[model samples]
Target: MARMIVAEMCPQCGSLDVRATEPGWFRIEWDRRDALDGGWVEHLEFGCRDCGMTWD
Candidate 1:
């Protein structure tokens, strides 16, 4: 039997139906205005259509 190495999944419910949530102000919110800024955290939001769950 074949085994899955690393399957990306939703933490809420065990389902593969997952989609990436768009970032409205991705560039403006994430990008630093100048070089002086450092150690900024980034997020990748995901939404599950099956159970209507969202997480980052």
Candidate 2:
């Protein structure tokens, strides 16, 4: 199994005030064959209604 991580940031202004209008799940992949292959692989989806910005 792999662990996933997501961040809230504004793509336009690069602000941390980014909020999630829609919440969802993100799937991550891990490469057991490689030592440093296990990390953040995918992001679900999130949209900021404040600035009308969408990010993952």
Candidate 3:
């Protein structure tokens, strides 16, 4: 079986605490940022909660 490349680790702390920065229950308005930006501007983002780093 061929292994697929999934993600690039966080550079700062080298922690795997990275995931899609989703809008939680309290902040439904956060979803609007996606539409305002564009098709994939803030919609698909990677965030590392470990060091609190978020990026597109």
Give the whole-model CA lDDT for all candidates, comma-separated: 0.67, 0.57, 0.66
The Cα error of candidate 1 at residue 53, in Å, is 0.6
Among all candidates shown, the one with the greatest TM-score = 1
Task: Provide TM-scores for the models.
Answer: 0.49, 0.34, 0.45
The list of candidate 1 runs beyond 4 A from truth reads 1-7, 25-42
Residues 1-56 of candidate 1: C-alpha lDDT, one tens digit per residue: 99877655788897888887546534454445344346433446788878988887
Selected candidate, larger lDDT, 2 vs 3: 3
Ranking by lDDT: 1, 3, 2
Candidate 3 local lDDT, residue 35: 60
* lDDT tens digits, residue span 1-56, model 3: 99898875777788788887544323437668566545343345677879978776
Model 1, residue 31: C-alpha shift (Å)? 19
lDDT of 3 at 39: 37
State the lDDT at 6 in candidate 2.
72
Model 1: ten consecutive residues of lowest lDDT: 33-42
Better of 1 and 3 by TM-score: 1
Best-first order by TM-score: 1, 3, 2
